[model samples]
Target: MKMMKNFRNEDGFSLIELLFSITVLSVGLLGIASTIPFGYKAIEQSAKRSTAASLLNEGLEKLKGYQYINLIESNFPDEVYGDIPDFPDFARTYEIRMASDVYSSPIPELKMVTITVFWRVSATNEQRIFAVTYIGQRR
Candidate 1:
């Protein structure tokens, strides 16, 4: 009696299997690549927002240092005023509005001041605005 030996076939992946795996991996990589631009845009927007907020804070601090009497009695200045002076180069394109008023509040003697900073996002006609408020006591 002759016995036949059973040998297991151990070859590399078949053509079909290899092609399918490459196709799937390529698709996944392409999908991830498509999102890169969007991620970059989000990061840019966040940076712009942070810079705008800082500028707004700087404007507020300038108001704080002014004579309390000037703050309470004077209307919001038509222009941006501060020791730091001008906006950083990045923010030069932004439009800023400053408003001051004496309103009927618990503190009638104090003035209510609002500072708003506005800018146009790149490629967008819409305006973005950031604002800060402070109350100043009559000197």
Candidate 2:
């Protein structure tokens, strides 16, 4: 009588090994899936910041385009041009403050102009601010 050969000794992964690999793969996939929403949120916040910066720059340009002679010695609210159109929607409110160096020199100059843009982001009612400064010359 010939003895039966042990054919069960094939070199391959067992059922337990296969199951463990599948479990690990599933966990990794789940971790990746969870991060997707967080990535989207980060992108949204970055966009809001970019919009605020653009709005501030727009305000600065508007101030620069005006007649330089009138701006050289003017003060806050007087030199500010609040009615300029096409402000970005992301900024809920914006303001400009102008300061002059009338006491310093023979030709008083625009010391500084500050532009502030404010906006809210997310459901928690958080706020972000963007500001820029510019100096103008006397025409």
Candidate 3:
């Protein structure tokens, strides 16, 4: 009968149980908070890669617009891309060189075009993306 009376009186959690629950909740919240920085970094890197790919495609399209005679006779100039309002951190360049043995015979009628995009991923590390394509005399 005395034990029943004590049990009835203790309808809520003890102080130790309440403190333990609070500590557990705090640790779980902290663990979730720790991942936010890594998620943000991943998102940033993805955006940079997307921008680099777009630049590469644009450079190739401009080169492809030239006619076969003009494209064959001319040399691709080295370009230093800088100071775009949209992509402030990026640097881009491109080059064209004669390719060998594209046909069965050694006429040297083919050309290899390469586009390179670079950026600083961090204070000391650099990141780059390159695209290469072959251009033959237009039919």
Candidate 4:
């Protein structure tokens, strides 16, 4: 008789238990689904930053190849590219100026080359990254 009673209690999960389990599982799945959009946006932001850094490096490399004086002759133009290019909503610019305040700074012997990469962060806001390097007169 005792064995029969125990068997009756252990037959299977009750209807209330099944409903509770399903409710908990559904909540967990919903929590997971809410994070997907945030993850995708984060990935997008990281890619843009990487491209900006790459553009900065390329600009600096070209500057390294030129005579320090040549770059100072004219103001560098604003570099801009579209989504069709590697970086989306991106514009990069460079400036060659004398890094020092002394009299000799007028010459190109010591120059401060600024490479800046800018991007549209939002509809009304923009962000930029810059690299400053000094090109000394290498005798």
lDDT of each: 0.57, 0.59, 0.77, 0.79
TM-score of 1: 0.67
lDDT of 1 by residue, 28-116 (tens): 99999999999998998787677767877776777767775666424444443232355432331222222323334565454445556
**Model 4 lDDT on a 0 to 1 scale:** 0.79
| RMSD, one per candidate, in order | 5.8, 5.4, 3.6, 3.7
User: Candidate 4, residues 20-101: lDDT per residue as tens digits?
Assistant: 9999999999999999999999998898889889888888887866775577736467767573265658988887777774
CA shift of 34, model 4, Å: 0.7
The pairs that clash in candidate 3 are: none
Q: What is the lDDT for 27 in model 3?
A: 100
Candidate 2 similarity to native, TM-score:
0.66
lDDT against true structure, model 3: 0.77
| Model 1 lDDT, residue 134, Cα | 50
Instruction: Please report the TM-score between candidate 4 and the true structure.
Output: 0.80
Ten-residue region with minimum lDDT total, candidate 3: 72-81
Give the C-alpha lDDT of model 2.
Answer: 0.59
Point out where model 1 deviates above 4 Å. Answer: 1-8, 72-103, 123-127
